[model samples]
Target chain A: MSTVLLEEEMTDTPAAPARLLSAGPAAPGQEAAWEQFTKIPLPTRTDERWRFANVKDLDLSPYLQPQPVDETTREELLARSRGLEKAAGRMVFANDQLLSREVLSESLTRLGVVWLPLEQALVEYPDLLQQYFMREEAILGGQKFAALHASQVRTGMLLFVPRGIEIDLPVEAFHWLHGANSSCFPHTLIIAEERAKVTVVDYYESADTNAPGLACAVNDLWLGAGAQVTYVCAQNWSREALAFQINATVVGRDAQARSLFAQLGGRHVRSESVSHLRGPGGRSDMLALTVADNAQEVDARTFQIHEAPNTSSDLLYKNSLDDAARTIFSGLIRVDPGAQMTDAYQKVRNLLLSDDAEANSAPGLEIEADNVRCTHGATSGQIEQEELFYLMSRGISKRAAQKLIVNGFLQEVIERLDQPEIGARLAEMVQAKFAAHR
Target chain B: MSSLKIQDLHVRIGEKEIIRGLTLEIPKGEVHAIMGPNGSGKSTLSKAIGGHPDYTITSGDVLLDGVSILGMEPDERARQGLFLAFQYPMEIPGVSNANFLRAALNSRQSEGEEIEAVDFYEHLYEEMDKLEMRREFTSRAVNEGFSGGEKKRNEILQMAMLKPKYAILDETDSGLDIDALKIVSAGVNAQRGPNIGCLVITHYQRLLDYIVPDVVHVMVDGRIVRNGPKELALELEEKGYDFIKDALAEPVSA
Candidate 1:
């Protein structure tokens, strides 16, 4: 497998044959959207949404859409795509191409569920795709990239849980960027109808940590009236790669939606997450954890919008920075005028491991509603000396003690997920990342 | 083989000397109690010997089993079989007591050696039973939100689990009630043997009633001025530290 991957690296030819945008049996309205993508200018630092970002890295000339891999590389990737022991369904994609799909149980299909690749779903359920695809605007920025994703994204998962159905196990999707200078745009759109319940996990990882690549990803979640949905996105890109992920969630009347974003490995990552409580008695929980080391920079932005009466939303983001790493967290909670009796909270905590590392937090709130309760806070601090002393007094070396404390800091966010297996796995992965740096 | 010897140890925080040339020796097969007044540097001596960074060892040496541990780090000193039961144990928010103890034990092993999970749990349960600690305490974060007595008991529990050669209990009886003091002392007494040496630093002799020491020393102005058998503690308890200070005022012959 290594020999085949090495052979592919030696070849200078483009991995995938660039299909001339010939009007070959185009999907009805997609062509116009594709045309719109070509017209939209790439984002620049001048744009308010792209402020404080390294816009020069937005150049897309060197990254080509990668082609499908040979059998050996494909088998190797499939072998490594394993995740949790019991997943409802699993799909593996390599270099923007589907490699394997496994529907573990027939019960899921019989329950009126639609879990398939985006292209297949588009062909079979175009109306459903049209009703939900890109429905929630990229309000937190990444509009141009969202447009590009809409134009070029061809492989991902589209999950639809019908009304009154609940899938107990989580659905898993894996996206791998294989070659150097490769770019993959992965999209996940999930809609849970009234009284429906489901959980979905998306894993973004690179084949090699030092390989340069670009990952432009987007996920949209819609919870119907009285539905409950939990989504988790674990991003572990290579050290030399650049990643951008935009997530938008809409919660309906009497519904609950919780989303966790775990940023484990990325050279330079910018994630924008937004939750909209659009119906009465709706609730949304937004949680994120990031461990940044070396020269990595993780920029995260979040928004909690209460648009209806008696709604609640909470957002928590925790980051641990070491060496010369950097992290920025900007979050806002906005309650509309009609969102009376609303409850909203936002908190950002940063644990700095090195004196030279930097963390910037900006928390804001704008409420036009009456009888509402809201609070927002941001804190950046080093590990308490007493806490370190406590650990060292127990025979743990200073380095190991620091690592444990940092892990404990991030574990608080992971623990809030209420899923033991997932929380333990994430903690282990974060600890492994810390150990590798040592 | 296990002993702690402090010779003319002068410790300071910045320019102010706290422990002014103190000297004491505790050997294995014995438990020694250091009784002092409130501001007499009993806690400072314990911390200084454990290599606390804030307390500077100005001009003396602390030897553990004939090896000077003045230059070692706190953790290295711990690995060398020295333990300091803190007066106020720190609250580590998210690290469970079980994992914390496991890490300490893991550090004693060579590189790449792993602790067997089943055996670790068995050992932990046995130690918890000895300390009368609940199994649930294993899941709780170390000293977080624990009551005063609970924290002291937790300190003793850790001392028992680590099985150190020389254990320094600094004010372990400070906030504990009488009942809790007995329980905590029982845990300490259970570990007393020829292989372990204990230095119990306290302000009152009340704790000595439970964990009866083999030797008792009166400390004043950061120095041990008198040393005797267990009866010395009872004498100090009745006469108080002032009487001991008056006696130490007399000049000593060479």
Candidate 2:
């Protein structure tokens, strides 16, 4: 319905071989990780971490491993990969195969910042890839999915910002699932050396609106001492697709890392994020916004670990649920025994727009140090009737009024991003998503 | 040529009737004031005319420009050029005052028709200057964390930008100080012209001093008991509301 065309359906074509992964020889850790992935049992409702989640949807037997996309389909996806107007660099991938790559500027390259596809980076900078690739496991209960991603993720971006250098513009990556009943494993690993600053945006989309697909993604962000990094993940799969996004962040001394996860599409999505403030004076800000409509379900889990003194972590997640949609948020913050002066906070707010919509939130905090400050809270409610009446009294239609209120509710998180261009782009995406429902 | 006519309007909250058989009319190019004591249904009358969901009109009708709006929703009534300046304006978080006013104006336009940014900002800045509102106020949330005076000024700002055919000021002077009262009165006075009519509701005669209504009506119970010219407001101020109460208590000659 939107002017942003994704792809057209092509029927009656014989299915291609699906088990041929494009990734090269896996490292020792990745090999063992894949073995464990095959051995680890699928999650059940009995698991505490997956409580209240629809675990029955985790069956991936019907979805074949990604197959090589046809040239025509690949060209169509490449043409449809529209995003930020200008970026430091951009990469487009479909079905876990690199379709296109735009190299960085000469100035950036001279400064020793390497922005390469994961496969290329594995061959060119093997030492860096081996040291940081999947180094921090998914501790928020997506270990099996993370292992699968490690084994199959051949298409993504590896951005390495060397010491004392800063990139003014953000780098971008687009991952598309092209075929029906296919799966894509997209990984983004970023390492910002001491005093470096960089930002990366990852966009996950489907080529067909009605096709059923699976997307398993992992983003590992490593910030060296005094480094700063901002990472944004915008997931917009097809309506029938299922998605799992696992993210891990490790902040070093005096480093600052901010990450925003925006969930706007998909039939069912489960996101897990973990931030570890491993050094003194390190700061981590975790923000997420979910707009769930229809019968879709979104479940989010997060962990903030304070392992050193003078560390701080703040987390805020907001969801707007409409129709019979459902959302679940479970987050925890823990401070180690010696991590004194640790400041941590977690808050989740769910706005229910329809009578049948539902939200479940569980927030927890564990503090062992004596001088730490930790707080966590969750709230679920409907839009204020008075506010609704106020807008309606001004001659705005009820639907438009609700849209404005929802935008206002989610705008706070976007404003916190402090990057106006990126914020505006996200808002437009929100608008497009809402338009699709209409 | 146009008028807001409320004919024998009886409004209620749940089962208890508030405005009992109130009838009034304010044609274009006139300012009418309704002065009453506490619980005299002055606010209820304005709300009923504005199609507030809380107060339902049990009988009679509210006609805007000769068209009965009894069955219309609040937004529909609003789009028909009926504006209510609330006594306690609601605060909408994260919705900028500029955007709120723009939406109000935009709702009056035809489909796919957008207000030009150049003209909108020019007109908005002109009105803000008249209301003594700061430039930054436009970007702030609608009346959120605003003082009582600021909120009233914002309501006036909306009225100016919306340019409604008929405006209802329901107790707009209740929380305003003397200075704020003067500023708000100036804003209303600036908007006074042959194209607009107004109904100002107040508890005290003090507001009538600044706005200087052309006609003043006194309501004691649920009905307007007396109607007169501007001099009546001065008389009420000198004698207090007790004069009306005493006058009503006297037995009528059959």
Candidate 3:
């Protein structure tokens, strides 16, 4: 029949990865999500959101849905998913399958803290997951990729804390890609009630350094009045992999939120981050660091929205490019009419190590509020001659001196996080990437 | 043989020649001083000896322990045990003093060898305390937001940590207050021993009061015009550099 011929042709040209949901039947919401995704047209050069992006990396026909991981490989990845020594809870996922989850302390559970995998949370707390999961449409490009992620996302964590609850230790998750041309979607949704505080860390990596893979990740953080949240994502996927990461944060009255992203790997990575200051006395600190080498391309977009009065947002992104690598950063700080006394600052710095490396930065500001202070700028430079000579005159070699200078260049952003342990861990990962460059 | 020997060294900055055929030596176990007025090419000599990129040694031979270091890079010469204590130490933002010093010491080690973190901190604290530097300085960015006196003391701290065989302190007393001068001079005096040869370049006799040199060389124009005992620094400070220009019977030009 004609349908058989169509099916054969569909097989001949691979479709997007099949979703492996554990539930008996597909959720009705995902079908709609998929339908919405299929209807959205792919990005083109003329599109403003996809400006300066490499559209060739968007071809998804070659990628297959992540297959089931073998027991041996799963165990190997579990052993390799090393992170902070002590965490409140930790989860390890390989090939989009949850391998292990360390439960929170009994006292935490008794305090009304809820931490569950996405699949389990969907069955137990459907209303809560439905309310927060992928709720904000992708506003800064990657809309199609985000919908694809929403439909296929099967693993990640959902953490909820009640009012006045504070978790001193951090919660962490590790997502590892295992196979070639395989695709995985990771989603993290955290909701904190009034006066609650929490910190979370995510590590995205690959099992092999040379395997080509695809990772589309989305994380959302919602803070109620007076709540605080600190999030750090250390993305060190394989050098041959393609990655897309989208992040959104909403801060309520008298609340504070800080998030940092370190881009250390992947051949071509697209990252979008948005911060919403929705109430008075709300503050958001968004920071990013990228060490792009070889032929890697890292395109990053950020948005800071001041939706309420007396709110503030600060953004700093630093990039160190070497060996023909390129990086793009486009950021905007928007102040709504009612958001008076809003203070917003955005800065992007690019440190080029090689002549062939390229850096493109576009910093924009839109202010509709009166009595507001907003400043935005971008700078690109190489190491200072005097700084280099000063270090080298003390017997530091050219390479080591360059390393010191680059570390200093990137340290300003890391220190702004104010998390010494997490910052140190991130610095180590950055050094590891630098060590690999011949 | 074990000395920092400069024989007929000529240095040029851009198209103009700064040092015109200067020769001097500071043997091990001695603290020799170079006293000159401003624009007498004293700083240029130090920079040339340290292989600063801007100062090219047109025709010179600077020997470290009888081996010529003309072909080595600045860092290589530094590893060869030649140290230059800059008068105006650079302020490197975001790089802590501790990390900078550690990187310097690590560069001196053989490949695949690194200093243990604990041991490094222990030794660093010891030296910093000797210099009367507060413990908080270890974590501060190198010389960033530091006072003039503090910058001079930091140079001394580096000198104490490196303990090089040959050292050229170019105008170390230029920016220091009286109290700072005493502390920094004492720190330098602590490293005065048989293994090091020092060249203390100064424009005033104030620093020499604390750090007494064994001998003094007076430079006029681009060459050393006279050599005397440590009292020459006092004499030069008393009579002023015009006496040297009068004695040279020529116009002093850099």
Lowest lDDT sum, 10 consecutive residues, model 1 chain A, at A18-27
The residue-by-residue lDDT of candidate 3 on B1-254, one tens digit each, is: 99999988899999988888888989999999999888889999998888888898989798999999989888999999989889888998888999999999998898989999999998889999989999999999999999988998899899888879999998999888899999999999999999999999998888899999999998877888888899989899899999888888533211
Interface DockQ per candidate:
0.75, 0.71, 0.81
Model 1: colliding residue pairs? none
Q: In candidate 2, which residue pairs clash?
A: none
Task: Give lDDT tens digits, candidate 2, residues A325-417.
Answer: 999999999999989999998989899999999999989888899998998999998998778877887898888888888988898888878
Each candidate: fraction of true contacts kept? 0.65, 0.60, 0.76
Tens-digit per-residue lDDT, B1-254, candidate 2: 39988877788999999888777889899999988889999888877787778897889888899999989988898898989999999988777888888888888889989899889999999999999999999888889999999999999999898888999999999789999999999999999999999999998888888898888888866787888898998898889989889888522110
Between candidates 1 and 2, name the one with more favorable lDDT: 2
Candidate 3: stretches off by over 4 Å: A1-28, B249-254
Question: TM-scores of the models, in the given order?
Answer: 0.95, 0.94, 0.95
Candidate 2 segments exceeding 4 Å error = A1-15, A19-30, B249-254
DockQ, model 2, C-alpha based: 0.71
| Candidate 1: segments with Cα more than 4 A from true spot | A1-47, B250-254
- The local lDDT score (0 to 100) that residue A121 gets in candidate 1 is 91
User: How big is the positional error of residue A238 in model 2, measured in Å on the Cα after superposition?
Assistant: 0.9
